[model samples]
Target: MSDAMIKVALIGNPNTGKTSLFNHLTGLNQKVGNYPGITVDKKTGICKLSKTQKATILDLPGTYSLNASSADEKITIDTLNDATNEFSPDVAVVVTDVEQLKRNLLVFTQVKDLEIPTLLVINMADRMQSRGISLNIPQLEADLNTKIIVISSKLQTGIDDLKEAIISYTSLSTERCISAGKIENNTITHPELLTSLSAIELKKVQHRETIIRYQFINAALKKSYKIDRSKASDLQAKLDRIFTHKIFGYVIFGVLLLLIFQVIFEWSSVPMEFIDGAFGSLADWTKETLPEGMFTNLLAEGIIAGLGGIVIFIPQIAFLFLFIAILEESGYMSRVVFLMDKIMRRFGLSGKSVVPLISGAACAIPAIMATRNIESWKERLITILVTPFITCSARLPVYAILIALVIPSERVFWIFNWQGITLMALYIIGFAMALLSAYILHKTLKIESKSYFVVEMPKYKVPLFKNVAFTVIEKTKTFVFEAGKIILAISIILWVLASVGVNEKFDNADAIITESVSKNGFNEIQEVSLNNKVIRFKQSLADEASEAGKTITAQEINSAIAEKTPEFRQAVIDDEISALRLENSALGTIGKAIEPAIKPLGYDWKIGIALVSSFAAREVFIGTLATIYSVGSEGDDEEANTIKAKMESEVHASSGKKVFTFASGISLLLFYAFAMQCMSTLAIVKRETNGWKWPMVQLFGMTAIAYVAGLIAYQLLK
Candidate 1:
C-alpha cells in the first residue's frame, strides 16, 4: 500500500492460470483502469511480499510473445521496454504452463532479452504428475539462467516461494539470454525501435527471433524435463471427441446457454422487485420526511429515480459474471472456442474473437479491448464494429420492461418461461447479427492481415465458489458505480426538461387550474379542495422556497374526493386537468412534435420523447417514462404502481386503447436490440478506433437498421 513498494509485472500466455494467481495474491485489493493514453485495461493490485513489505502487481494483458500484434499487446511491449515507465517492474513474473514449456519459453526468452530480472513460474503444477510430466528443476534453472518456481495456482502452493524469488530479484542477472548484440542497444533498450523496420524486414526479423529463441529453449530443456505425450494427448482427445463433436457439442452448448439464461432470468427477478420497491419507497419517504422544496423534489424525482433504474439491474449483472466465472473455472469456454473455430473462420473471424463476442453480452468496452490477441486487423475491426449489436446489460432494463408488456408471465411446460425465452432470443439475435455483419464486412472491406489462433485446453475442474463470488462482486460494482454516475447526470437533466415548460401555460399551472375551477362554478367542497391544490402547486413553484410542514398528497386528495363524491368520477376529472396541464408543458409539446417520426413504429408522442431521451443511454428510457408520468400524474394511485404498471396504464389520446400494445412492445424491443443507444459505448469505440469515423458508422448505421427492424415488426404485428 505504501509508495516504496516494489512493482511486479505478471505476464503470461492465454490459459496459463495467471488470473488465478493474481486473485490469490491480491484477493479483493485489485483495481482495473485504463492506461493513460490507451483504452487497453491495466489491472493493478497490492500484494504483501512481506508483513511489512508490499509489492504492486500489474497484470498485463496475456500475450504469447513480446512482438506486438494488437492494441493491447502494444501496452505490454511499451511497459516492458521503458525502464523509466511508472509501471515498469523491478522484476517480472513470466507465468507459463509446464506442459507447454517449450512453447511458453518463447515469451520467457523475449522477456529475458529485455535485461530485466524475470522469475519463471511453471503454473498448474498439480496437473503435472497426473499428466505424467516431470521437470529437472535445478538443471532447468541453470540452463535458463533464471529462477524457476513450480506452483499450482489452483491448489495455491509455491506462492511464498515465488514471493521469496521476487524479494531476492536484486541478486538475479539482467543479462540477455539471446544476445541482442546484432541489434542496437537503443533499439533493445526501448520497445519503439521494433516499429522502425519495414513490413518485409520486420516479418523476417520477427520470424528469425522466434526460431532462435526456440532453438535455445529446446537446447536447455534437453534431458531436463519430460512429458508422457500419449497420456496427455489421450485425455484431451477423449474429451474433445464428445465436447467438440459436430452435433453433440453444439447441443451441449445450446443447452448450457439456455440454463444460464433461464436461471438468471428467473432468479434475478425476486431481488429486482425488492430493489425496485426499496428505491421507490425511499423516494416516497424522502418526499414525505423532508420539507417541501426543490431540494427534496430533486432528491425524490431526479437522484433517487435515476439511481433506482440502475440498482434494480444489479441482479442481472451479477448473474452475467457468475455464468462467466463458471465457464472460465470449468474450462469449457476454451473448448467452445476450439469447436466454433471452423464456423467462425467462414465469417472471417478467428476463434479468439469468441472471447470478446461472448463478453459483449455483459459490456462492449472491455470486450472490444479483449480482441487484442486476434492478430488480424481485418478480423479485429469486424469484431469491434459488430460487437455493439450484441445485447449488453445496458439494454436489459429496456428489454425486461418491454418484454413484460408484450410477453406474458407464464411458465412453459412447467420448466421454461416465456419471459426467459424472450430474453435468450434477444441475446441470440445480437450474436447472430454480429456474425452476419462480420461476414458482410468480410466480403466488402477487402482488407488483409495476419491471422493466428492457437489456444490451450486446460483440464476441467469444478468452479470454485470463492472465484465465482469475486467475479460477481467486481462486475456488479463496476456496473453500479461506473455506469451509475452517468445515469445520475442524465436523470438530473431529464428532470429539468420534463418538469418545466417553455410558455406561460407551463409556468402558471396553478393560475390556469384556479381559473378553470372558479369559472366552472364548482360546489363548495370541490372549490375548497381545488383552491388547496392550486395553493400547493403555487407553493411548489415559489421563487423563494421554504420548508412547508403541510403538503397536499395524492392520497389526501383521494380521501377528499371520496368524502365529497365518487372517487372514480373525481379521478377522471383530475386526470383531464392533469393531462391538459402537461399537454401545454414544454416536454409534452416536444413529444407531440416528434410523434409523427415514431408513429409508424406504433409509439405515441410520449414514447417518442422517452426514446429521444434514452438516445444517450438505453437505461434512461424507463426512468424517462417514470419522470414524465410522475410529472403529469394527479392521482395518488400512480405512486403505488411500478413504472411497468404506470406505463401499462397509459392510453392513446386518439384511440382510447392502452399505449403499450403487443405491436408497440415488440417494436420497442426490436428497436433497442439493434440501436446504438449508448453514447458511452460510442465514445469508447471512437477511442478504440482512434477516430470518430467508426463510431459514427456504428451510431447512424445501427440506428437505421433498428428503425427499419422496428417498423417491420410493428407493421406485421399490428
Candidate 2:
C-alpha cells in the first residue's frame, strides 16, 4: 500500500445490496452531494482499509451496465472512462448478488475492459444455500481474471476480507475479462472504428458488444455457478403473488399509508407540544434575562421563534422517513411501483416514473433528479414537471400546523383523528393531481418518444435497524439544516423589517397608545375582560385570607385590587403599543399592500406576508408566520405566545372574527398543496430540463391553479 489514500469506486446494479455494503463500510462517515456538473447524487465516504491505509469510497449510481442508456448509467460510464475525473477510482469493486452472478458479471467485465484495477464482490452469500445457489470463487476468479470475494452485506460477514482486498488493490489484475477484438466484427479492433461511427451505428456496436459480453459471462458461469432446484424456496413467489395482486396491493398500500399518518400524528404530538412550549419559554426567558437590546430581540423574537416553527415538526418528519426507509429496505417499495404500473400507464406514465413520484414525498429536488432513470425524455420531463405537486416533507410542516389549528382532533372510527385523516387526504390529493396533470400534458406536449418499464423484484428481507436509523437521521438532518438556513436568513430580514419603520405612527406608537388609553380607557370588550380578571383576583385573595383565619374588609380588598388593576392596565397598554408599532412597520406595509389580493381567500395582511415570504420554501410558511407573530410580542402574556396560541387568538381587524377559521385554514392547506413555492425545486427543474421554459411553466402554471383552487374552496366554505 502507498502512503497516499486509495480511491475505491463501489459500482453495482439496483437492489444488489450495494447501499447496505456502503453503509456497512462507511457507517456515519458518508456525505451526499451532487456530481461536479450534474444533478445526480454523489455519495462518498471514508473507510479504514487498515490502521495505516484509508480509502475514499465513492458509491456510484446503480446501473444495470455501462451501456449509457440513461443519465445514471452515463455517469457510471463517464466516470470510469475519464481517469482525470475526480471521482474516478484507483480501484473498482463490482458488487453482484450471489443469485444473479451471471447477469451481474456483465458490468464486471465492462469495468475490467476499462483497464482499471477491478475485483468482484458477490453479496448476500448468506442466502446462497437457502436459495440453492453456490459459487466457485476460485474458478470464477481465474475465468474472469479478477479477485472475487463472497460476502453477505446484511450479515456483515467477509467485510474484513473485502477491506483487505481493497487495501491490496495494487496487486489486482488490470487484464480485460474479454478481448475487444473478440467482439466478432469484420471491422478492425482499431481506435478509429469508434470515431467514424454515427450515434445509431455506435448504439448497434454497443448492443453487439453487450451480446458478446453476456455470451462470455454465460460460458464462465457454466463452470463456476450452480443452483439446486430441490432446495430453493417458493416463499418469495408466494409473497409476490399477494403483494402484487391488483386489488389487495392497493388496499394494503392504502392501509399502510393510513397507519403511517396516524402514527405520525399520535406519536409526534407530545414532542411537538413540548418543543413548542420549550421554544416559547426560551424566547420569553431570553427577553427577560438578556439586557434589553436589539440583538436580544432578534435572537428571541426572530431567530428562535422562526426556527421553532420548523424544529417542532422534527418528530413527524422523522416518523415519515422512518416508514419510507422501512418500506424501501424491506423490498416493499418496489412492489408498490409494480402495483402502480397499470394506473401509471393509464395516466401516460410508466412504472419507472413511480419511483420519482413516490420519492417526491421526501423532497422534490432529489425526486426530480431520480427521473434520470426514466428512459423516455417525454415521460421524464412530465415526471419532473408534476413532481412538485406530490406533497413533500416540506409541506408536512405547513399541513401539520394548519391541520392542528383548524381540524377537529376527534377520532375517525376508533384510531385515526380528523387531523391525521386530513393529512392523508392531502397526500392522496397531491398524488392524484400529479397524475391528472401528467395525463393533460401527455395530450398537450408534442414530444415523440418510445419507452418501456422494467422493474427488478428483489428478494424480501427484514429491514436492518441500523440502516433504517441512519436513513432517518440523515434525511431528517438534511431537512432541518437545509430549511433552517433559509428560515434563519429570512427571519433576520423579517425582524428588521418588522422592527424598523419610517412612518411617524411606528415611531410614536408608545406615546400614541398611552394617550389613547388615557382618553378612552379600555374598549367595551377589553374593560369587561379586565373587570372579570379583577374579580377573580380579589376573590382569590379573600379566599386565601379566610383560609388563614384572618378577616378581610371590603376596603382592604378594594385597595389590593386597585394596586393589581394598574399593573393589568399597564400590560394592556404595552400590548396595544406593540401591536400598533408592528402594524406600522415595514413588514406590515408590505403585508397590507398584498392584503387586498389575498383577502378574498380569507387571509389578512399577516398571512399575506407569510404567503409571500414562504415562496423561498413551503415550510417557510410556518416559520414566516411564527416570526411575524413574534414581532413586538414581548408584552403578550407569556403563556399565550406559542405560535399556535398566537394564531388561535388572532382576529380580523374590522370583522373581529378569528383569522384562522375553518374556511381559511382549508383554503391555506389547498394553496400550499398545489402551489409551486419552493425555489430549490424550480432551480432543480431548470437544470434537469436544460432550460427555463418548463420551470417557468411550473412556477406560473401551478400557482395559477393554486389560486383558483383556494379561491373556490374558501368561497364555498366561508
Candidate 3:
C-alpha cells in the first residue's frame, strides 16, 4: 500500500511504443521535471493497479543497451546500477516491439543480468497477425526466464494483464539470458567499472557481448516464435520510397508545411477571437465590479492583461503540437531524419541534426538536449548553436498578433490566406537561416570529428488519438504554466513602474492637464466633435418628443445638450490625464532611456519597453504590450478592447504614424526570428555547454544579427 514499495520503471529502445504505454497508464495524472543535478527531462505518473493499490511509473529515456553511449543512455545505466537511487525501479518493465524483438531484447538481457525483477512487454501485438508473427507467451517466458505481457498500445488491449504482471513482478525471474561474466569485469552489473574503459575498448566489449546475447536469443526464439515473411505487406515500403525520395520528398514536405500553417491560422481564428474577447470583458468587469483600489487596478491592468496575451494563443499552440505529435506517432519523422542526411552531409551536419532542428519548432531547450544523440561533438555543438534560429512556439504569440495587425487577412489564389502564407514564409526563413548558419559554422569551427549517421525507419501506422491528445495537452500546459510565472512577475513589476513615478511631471500630470485644458479651452477639432455630438443628441430628443405628439422648444434641446457637455468633456480630460501620467511614469522613463537604441529598428519608447521585458521570455513581448496598453488607457468600449485592438490603435507620439505598421511589424518579426531573447534559453545553453562562453557568444551574436536584420528590414520597407 505504501508508495515507496511500488516503483515501476518503463525501459526500452527508441520507437518501441514505451511512451505510449506510459501515457495509457498515466493519462493526465503526470508531472514533468528535470532529473536531479541534470537538465534531462524526468516524467513520472501514478497508475492504480487495483481499487486499493497504485504504483508510481517512471518513464526512463529510451536507450539501446546498458552501453551508456549517449547522455540518455548513461542516465539509464546509472539508475539501474545504483540500487540506492530513488528513481531505480523495484520492477523494471522492459518494453519491446513485436516486429523487432531481436534488437529490443539486447537491453532486456542486460537489465536481467543486473539481478533486478523484470517483465518483458511485447508491444504492438496488434501488428503480429498482419505481419505473420506468432509467439508462444508461456514457452517464451520459460526460455527467457521472465514473465511476458503482449500488449497493443494502439488497441488499448492487454493493459490489465500488464498491470497484473506488475503486481506479481516480485515472482518473475532475474536470471540472465547470458552470463554477466561474459562482459569484461561484469561492467553491465557494475557500471562504475566502465570508468576505466576507453570509449573504443568499451564499444568492442559491448559488441562482443551483444553477439553472445543474440546467439542465446536466437536459440530461445527458435523454439517459441514463428513468422511468415511472405504474409507481410509492402505498403510501408511503397510509401517510404516516395516519402524518402530525394526530389519529391522535399516537395511534399513543403506542401505539408503550407497546409499546416493554413490550418493553424484558419482553424484557430474563431477560438482565438473568442478568448481575446473573453479576457477583455473579464478585465473590464474586474475594474467595474471590484471596489476601486491600487490592487484592483493591478489585477485588471497587469495580471489579467498579461495572462490574456499568452492564453489567447493556446489554440494555435495546441494545433501546432497536434500536428507534430501526429507526424511523430505516424512514424514519418524518422523518414524525415533519414531524408535530410543527403543535404546534412553537405552542410557539415549529420542526419541526426534533423531531429533537433524539427523539434526546435516546439522549443529550443529540448531541441538542444536532443543533440546528445549525435555522436560527433562538433556536429552536436553546431546543431545546438543554430537550433534557436528555428522558430519556436514561444515566438508564435508575437508573430500571430503582429501578422494579424499588419498583414491583410485576404486570400491568395482564392485558397491560401495571405497571413498564413506570410507565417509559413517566416518559418521557412527560420529553417533556411539555421541551415545557412550551420554551413558557416561548419566551415569556421575547426574541431576534428567524424561520425556516420544511422537512423531507424519505423513502420508507419495510424497515429493513436490518445497519444496525440496527451501530447497537445502536455505541451500546451507546460507552455502556459512555465511562461505564465515569468509573465506574472514582470507584469506586476511593470504595473508598479507604470503606475508610480519619480519625477514631478508624473505627479503633476492631472494638474498640468487640467490647467492646459482650462487655459486653451476646447481645440478646433475638439470643439467640432463636441458640437456634432450635441447636434446628434438634439435631433434624437426632438424626434422622440415629436413622436409623443408633444411640442419641444429649441431652448429645451439646448438645455439638454448643455447638461451632458461637461460629462463628455470630463471623459476626454481624464483620458489625457492617464496618458500624460503614463508617459512620465517610471516605466516610461526606462523606455525613453533605451529608445534611441531601438529607434533605428522602427520602434518607439513603448516598443523598447516590450523588447527589454521580453528578454525574460520571447512570448512576454505581447504580454508586455498588453500590460503597457492596459495601464495607459482608461474607459474602453468592451467590444474593441482586445489586445490586438489596442495594439492596432497605437501610434507614435512624435510622428503620429501607426506603431504596428507594415514596415515596423515586419521589422519586429525579423528581430524576433533572429534574436536569442530568452534568458532561460541562454541559461540552458550555458548548462549544456558547461560554461558561459558559448551562451555569451550566442547571446551577443544573435542580438547583433537581430538588430541588423530589423534595421535593414525597416529601412527598406519604410
Candidate 4:
C-alpha cells in the first residue's frame, strides 16, 4: 500500500493539557524547530495510524482564544486561517480541560466556526469522576456537531478511542457553530455598539463571542455536566497561602534555588570527570596511534580536544535543565512567577518576565524569544535586555573550570562544599545583577505601553516522568549540537592560527631549542633521541639522591627526571618552543596586540587570544584554552594531564609567576559572568526587536560592564 499522510493540528487554550497529549502521541518521534521566517517554536510529531496511513501531528502554540495578542498566538492564527498552508490539517484536535470546560470550550467553538473538521478531546477524564463531573457524551456530540473523545492524558486512557475518531475524520462535521455572516470583515455586529473593527476591536468581539459560546455550552452541559463542591480540596488553598506568603515565599524560593545549584555541582561531578577522562584518552590514543602528520594533529588536538570541552559539560547542563523541567511540570513555576511579580514590577518588568528570566538559565536565545508573551513593549524590551545577565549554561564550562581553580574543595560550615558555595554565589550574582540592571533601565528608557500580566495557576500534580525525561534529553541535545558546531569550527581555526608561523623564527624552532638547551649546560639530545637520553639521565638523578643521603620518592624521582632528563626536559623545551611559535602565529599576534588592554585584568597574551576567540561563544573559552594548551602538551602522560592541571602548572612569560592565580581567576570569572559573548544571542535580539539598535546597545553596554567589573575584581584582589 502506498503510504498516505494526514496533517492533524493540535490546538487548545493554555493549561488545557494540549502539550501532554502531544508528548504522548509523539513520544521520542517528535521534532522541535522554529517555524520558517519566525522565531516562534514549532513542534511536530509523527504517529502511525495504520500500515496505510500516518498522522503528522503539529502542536501549535497554546493561546487563550482566536483573537491573536502576541507573536506566539499569531502562529495559531496563521496556521488555521490559511488553507493553502502546507501545515494545514485534515482534522483539527481541540483539547480542553474537563474541570475548566467552560473557558476551554471558547476556543473549540471558535475553531469549529473556521469550518474545519474538528475533534473535541476532553482531557483529564480521570478527574471527572473524582470531581463528580459527568458529561452527556451523546447529547454534546449531537449539539456541537463534532465527535467528543474523553481521555486522561496523564493516565493514557481513551487515547485509542481518540485515534479511531481521527482515522474516521471524513465522517466528522465542518459546520461552523457560529455563522460566517456574524463576523464578516473582521467586524462583529453585536448589541454592544461598535464601528469597523481592528485587532483591539476583534478582542472585544472575542470577549462577547465567549459569552455567546458559553450560552451553548451551558445548554449542552445542563444535563451533561455537574460538579460536586464537596470533592474540592482545601489543600490547594492552604498551600497557596504559605507558598505565596510575602516573607516565606521568598525564603522558600531562595532555598530551593540554592539547593538546585548545590545538587548540580555534587551530582554532575562523577559523570563530568568520566567524560573528561574518556575524551582525553581518545585524543591521547589518536596522537599515539595515528601517523605523524598535520591532519592527525588536527584531528586529535583541534577536533577531539575541542569536542571534549563541550561534551564534558553535558552533565551539568542536563542537571540544570532537569531541575527546571521538574519545576515546570510540577506547577511550582507558576507560583514563582506570581511571587516575583511584585518585585519585578518595581523594575519596570511585568510579572511574566519571570518565565524568560528563569529560562535564561538554559539559554538566552529561547529566553529572549519567550519574552514575546509580555504584552507591554517597554517591559518586554527591558526583560529581553537584561535576560542575558542571568547565568546561562554557556557560561557553565568557564565558571566550572575557574571556580574549581580558585575555590578550594574544603567544606564550609562543615556541611557545604566551598566550591559549591562559590558556584551558587555566582548564580545569585547573575540574578541580582539582572534585577538591578532592569531597575536602572526602567528609570532610563522612556518607552512605555499598557501592560497586562496573566498566568494560570495550574493545580499541583506529580510531574510525569515521561515529560521530564523527554525535556532533559531534548534540551541537552540542543545545547550540545548548537554549541558544539561553533566550538568545533573555532577550534580548527584556532589550531591553524597557533600552528602556522609568520616568519623564519617558527621554522627554526628545533635549532633554537637545541642551542638553548646546550647553552644552559644540559646535554644536547635532538628531539628524536631525547627518550634514550632521559632514561639514562633518570638513573643519574637516583644515584645523586642516594649519595646525598636524601630519600627520593618515586614521584620525586619522576619529578627529578622531568626536570633533568633530556627526554622529559625536551618536552619542556618543546613546550617553550610551541609557546614562542604561537606567540608569532596569527592568533598570537592578535592576542599580543590586545595584551595591553587586558593586562590590568591579570590576563596575558595567551588569555587575550582565548578571550578574543570566546566572543563567538562563552562556552568556547574552555575549548579555546584546551586547543592552545594541547599544542605544548606533547610527551606528557595523557592520563595525568587535565586543563586545570595544565593551568596550575603554567608560568607567566613575563612575571615567571603562576597564571590563573586567585586574583586572575576572580577576574576571569567576573568577566564570563557578565560578558555578552554570544553572537547568536545578539542576532536573536536583533530579530526580536526587528532592529540592530537594541542589540548594539546590549552588546557594548554589557561588554563595558564586564570590563569594568573585571578590572575592579582583579585590582582589589591582585
Candidate 5:
C-alpha cells in the first residue's frame, strides 16, 4: 500500500480555501466531470508525490457536515463512505481557515469519525503574521492526534512543508481529536427528542460542537495564535453596515450589477478582436493550404469558423467567473445571499437561488445543477426552469455580432459604448424575463415542500490567488467542452442543409431566374449587361458554395434533381448545370424557399437563411452570416462590418430597395434577444426536467414571443 498510488480527498466547509490547497498541490493537471446521476461537478487531479508513489487528489464538493442533506453533500458523503466509488481516499486532508478554525473543525471531526488517515491544514498563515497571531503547531498537532500544516495558499508559503506532510502520510493518525463522546451518548439516548427539534435547536447542536472545538482553538491561540484586536481594521464591518443595509442593500446591489456588465463589455473587446482575427487567419490558411475540395471547406468553414464563434467568448466568460470566484472566496457572495433571502422568498425562490442565477450569466447547465442547494422542491424547480432566461456566455457571440451589425458604436453618457449598453440591456431583459417567469411559476406550481434558508456569513478574508485561478480555469474548461460538442454537431448539420437542395426546385432555379431577368428587358441590352448579370448570378452561387462549403456537392445536387425529372434528362441537365453554376458557386439559393415568409420581417433570402440557421445557437448565427457574406465577396475579409456592408448594399429583387434597412437590422436584433432558439439549451432543459413537455413549452413560448416582438419592431420602425 505504501508503494501504491495513494488517493487523497480534500474536504472542508465552503469558503475555507479547500480549493486553494488542491490547486497548489495539483496545478493545471486537473479534470472536471459530473458526479454519477447528478450534475454537480467532480474535480480530480494528479499530484506527484515521488518517483513510484503518486497521489490522486480529489477536491470533493464543500460541505458543512457528513450528514448529507443537499445533492452536493451527498456526493461528498457517498464517495467517502463507499469504497466501491474508487474515489474514496486512503488519506483525508481537512483544510481549515485559521480565522474560522473552530467552525471548520466540526467537519474535520466528522471526517475523523470515519476513521480515515487525516492531516489538518491551517491555511492563511500569512494573515496570522500580519495580525500578530501565533500558533503552537506542535501542541495543536498533539491535541488533534494528526499532523498540522500551517500554510498560506496566497503567497505559496509552507507549500513544500505541506508536500512533505503528504509524503509522510502514513505517520498521520485517525484518532478522535476532541471529547465528543459524552455529547454523542446524550444525543443517542434522547434521539426521539432531538428529532423533533426546531431549526434553532439544530443550529444549537452545531454551535455546541463549535464551542467545544473553540476551547482547544483558544488554547492554541494563546500559545501560538495572536492578534491585536484593537489595531485590527474594521473595514469589513463598516462596508457591511452600508452594503447590507435593509433598504440601500438592494440599491447597491443593482448599481454593482450595472457596473459589472459595463466592465465586461468594455474590457473584453480587445481580447475578442484578437481571437476573432486569429481564427479568421486560421480559416483562410486552411482554405488555401488544404487543396480546394469538400474536406477543405468542412475544415475551414464548417468546423474552424463554427468553433471560433464559441472560443472567442472564452475571455469574457473567464473574466465573469473570476469576479464570481473572488466574490465567493471573500465571503461577500454569502452576505449577498443573506441580504437577498427576504426578497427571493417573496418570489418563491431561496437565497441559494441567487448563486445559480449569477452563475447562469456564464452558462445555464451548471446553474440548474446549482439549484440542488435549495431545500424546497418548488423553489428548486422554479429556479431551474427560469435560469435559462439569464443570458449565458453562449449568447455572447450572438449579441456581440448582432450589436456590431445593428447598434451604432457612438458613446452614451460619456462612458458607455452604445453597443455595450445594448448588450447589457439584452442581459437585463433576460433577467427580467426570468423573474417574471418565476413569479408566474410560483402561482402555477402547487407542490407543497417546506422551504428553509440558513446560511453562515463567514467573516471577510482576502481571497487566495491559487483558488481564484483554479476556479477560473476549471469553470472555463467546463464551459468549452459542454457547449463545444453541441456547436460542432449543429454546424455540420446546418452546412449540409444549406449546401444541398432537393428536386427540380433548386435544379431549375437558374433558368427561371435568367428567363425572368430576360423578360424584364435584360435580353435587349448589350452583351456587357448580360455578362454583368451572369457574373452577379455566379457570385451569388459562389457565396452559397462558400457559405455551405462541402457539406453539399454537385453530385448530391444532381441526384436530388434526377429524382424530380427522370424523363426530362436534357432539360434537367441544362437546368442543373445552370443552377449549379449559380448555387454551387456561392450564396445563391439560401432565401428562395423562405423568402415570402421572411419578407414581412424585412429580410431577403440570405438574411432569412441566416436567421433560421442561427436557431441552433446564437453565436453560430454570426459565423453563419459571415460565411454567407464571405462567399459572395471578392476579397478575403471576414470582418463583421464588411459582412454588414455587403448586406446593406445588396438590392432586393421584389422591391429594388436596399435589403438591410435600419428597421430590418433593429428587427433582427430584437428577434435574437427574445428568441429561445438555442438547441443546446432545449436539450439541457429536457435533461434537467427529465421530459419533453417543459422544453417544448419553453421553445414554442419563446418563439411566439420573438415573432410578436420582431413583427412589432419592424412595423413600427419602418
Candidate 6:
C-alpha cells in the first residue's frame, strides 16, 4: 500500500474481547457511528505506530463467519471484500482467547481463507496461567501460517507485543493453512465424496491456491495441539448441573431478575437525591440572582427544570447499564439466552431475541435495532413490535416521581424501599406484558422463514472495570443528549406559550374580571378586595424588612392580589396579566378543546394543557406541571405552595372528587409507562425498519394499550 496510512481491521466472533483489545490499542480516541445504510455501529480509531507512520484501525462488528446471515456479519464481509468501500484493510487481526481455542479457530480459519495478511492474537494469557492451560505457539503459528501474538487486555500485559506485531504487519502471511473437513469419516470413504474432493482440489490447483492449508493443519495438530485432561477444570460441568438444569435454571433466572430490579432501584437513590437537590438549589439561585423577567423565569423554571428532570435519572440509567455490560462482558449473557431458548422458541422467538429483550430495559430504539441479528423475519418482527413494552429508562422518571407521590414510603419487608419496590413491580409488569404480546404475535403472524439459534459461549473472565465504565458513560451520554434535546425544546415552547399573549389578551383580563364580578352583584367583592389589600400590604411590609426578603414579600402580595381580586380589579397586575395571556395562547386553545374528552380522567383544562404539551416526552410532564404552577403563582412561597397544595387537594368539577388522587397518579403512571410517547424512538424505528409500517404499528398499538390500561386503572381506582 504505498506510503499512505495502512488500514488494519480487527474482526472476531462475539464476546472474543475484540472490543477490549481495540480499546487497549486505541485508548479513548475511538469514534463510533453507524455503518453505511445500516444501523449497526462502525467504530474506527487511529493507532499511532510511530511519529511518522500512523495506522487507521477499524473495529468491525463481531461476527462468526463470512456467511453473511445477519446485517452485522454482512457489513463485515461486504466491507472486507469490496476494494472501493475504503473499509478494506491491508492487515486483518483475528483475536482468539486461549481457553476457547477450537471455537475461536472457526473464525480464524475463515479470515485466513479470505487471503488477507492475518495475525492471530491469543488474548487472556493470564487466564491460561490460572487455569493451567498451555499452548504450543510455534506449532500453532506453523499450522495457521500466520504470526501469533499473546496478550491480556485485563491485566494490561503483552499489549506492547501486540503493538509490535501490528507495526510489523508486512511480515504476516496471506496463505491459508487449513481446510474445513468432511462431515463424516464414511463420507471420506464414499466414491462420490472422493470425486467431490478431487474436483475441489483440481479447482484449487488450477487457481494456484494453497494446497498446504489442509496439510499444515493436519501436521501441526499432530505436533502441537494437546488437551491437558488432568488439568481441565470441572467448573462448567458443576455449574451447568445447577444453572442450566430444567427446574433450577428457571428458578434461578427469575430470582436473578428480581434481585437486579431491587438493586437498581435501591442503589440509585442516593445519587438521584443528590442530583435532585443540586438542581433545585441551582434553580433557586438562578431566580434570586437574575433580574425578574421572562428570561429569568425561562432559565430557572423551564430549561433548567426540564433538563434536571432528565439528568436526575442518569444515575439510575448508569447503574442499569453497568450491570448489563458486566453480564455481557463476562459472557454470562449467552447463558441466559441458552437457558431461555426453549421457552423463547415456543413463542416463535430464537434465543438471540434475549439480547434485544435485555437491551430494551435501557431503551427500545437500540433494542429494536438489535433484532437485526435474528435469522427469522417472523421472530425479528415480533421482537421489534413487543420490545417497547419493556420498561425503559425514559419511563423511570415518570415512575419515580409518581410512585413517590402516591405510594407510601413504608418498607415492604422492613428493608425494601416500598416506593422503590412498587417502581420495580411496574418494570416487571412491563416485561410480562412484552412476553405476553410476543406470544400473541407469534401465534397470529404467519410469515415463514428459516430459524436458527447459534451463539459462542466465550470463556468467562472477570469483567474489565474500564470497559464497564466506558459503556456506562457512553450509554448514559446518549440517553441524556437524545432525550434532553427533545425535552428542552418542548419546555421552551411551553414556556413561551405560558409567558406572553397577543393583542389585548394580556391587557384586558383585569378589566374583564372586575366587570363580570360587578355585574354579578356579588357582595363578596368587598370582602375579596379587603383580603387583597391586606395581603398586598403585608407583602410591601415584608419587602421593606430586608434585602434578602424583598422578592418573597412581592411574590406573596402578588399571589394574594391574584387570588382575592378579580383580574380586572387587581392593581399591579403582572401575575394576572401573565395568566390571562396563557389562557389565550395556542396551546391554551388546544387544551380547552381537549378538556371535555379528558374530564373523565380527573383533569381540568389546565392539566389537560399540560398533558398535551407533555406528549413530546414523559419527563416533560413534570416540567410542564412546574411551569403551569409557576405561572399561576403570585410569586410568593406561601402563595405558590398554597396554590399547589390546593391543586393537589381540589376535586375535578365534573367528577366532584380529588383531581390528583392516588387513582389519577397511578393512571398517569401506567399511561406514561406503556405509551410510545417518544418521537425519537419512532424516528429510530423508522430508520431501522426502513419503512413506515413498523413504526405505525408500534405507535398505534402502544397508544391503544396505554389508553385501555389507563381507562381501567382510573375507573377501578376512582
Which prediction has more favorable lDDT, 4 or 5? 4
TM-score preference between candidates 4 and 5, better one: 4
TM-score of each: 0.67, 0.70, 0.69, 0.69, 0.58, 0.62
- What does the lDDT read for residue 529 in candidate 6? 32
Off by over 4 Å in 5: 1-233, 281-290, 503-616, 631-633, 636-653, 656-662, 687-690
Q: lDDT for model 2, on a 0 to 1 scale?
A: 0.87
Candidate 6 C-alpha lDDT tens digits along 110-192: 67766778888888877764454677888778767889888888898887787677778888887655443421322211224
What's the CA error at residue 541 for candidate 6, in Å? 21
Model 6 segments more than 4 A misplaced: 1-233, 270-274, 502-506, 510-581, 603-615, 632-658
lDDT of candidate 5 at residue 254, scale 0 to 100: 70
Worst 10 residues of 2 by lDDT: 185-194
lDDT of 4: 0.82
Name the 10 consecutive residues with the lowest summed lDDT in model 6: 182-191
Residues 593-694 of candidate 1: C-alpha lDDT, one tens digit per residue: 999999999999888887898877778887777766655344433234356656766777665667899998999998998998887888888887899999
lDDT by residue (tens digit), candidate 5, 1-718: 3777788999999988889889988989899998878999989999887677678899999988765557887787777767688798988899998877766877777677666789889888777644434567786777677888888998988888877788788777766666557354223223343457676776567556554544554444455444443244456545666667788887887766666766776788788878877777787778778897777777766677667767877887888788878888988877788787777777878777888998887777778877765656788888887887888777776666667656788987877777877877788788777778888889998989766543444678999999999999998898787667766875565555545655555556667655665576332222332333334444544577789773556665556445533333332233334434335433455466677787777877767766777776666666565555433123223442233344444555445565666688777777776678677778877887789998888888777767777788889988
In candidate 1, stretches whose alpha carbon ends up further than 4 angstroms from where it belongs are 1-98, 101-103, 108-237, 507-565, 632-639
Question: What is candidate 2's lDDT per residue for 124-194, written digit by digit as tens?
Answer: 88887766666777898899998998899888999999999998898988988888677754122233454
Residue 409's lDDT in candidate 2 = 97
Q: What is the lDDT of residue 496 in candidate 2?
A: 97
For model 4 the local lDDT of residue 22 reads 93
**Clash number by candidate, in order:** 0, 0, 0, 0, 18, 7
Question: Residue pairs in steric clash, candidate 6?
Answer: 177-213, 510-567, 510-568, 511-568, 555-635, 555-636, 559-634
Error of 5 at 89 (Å): 26
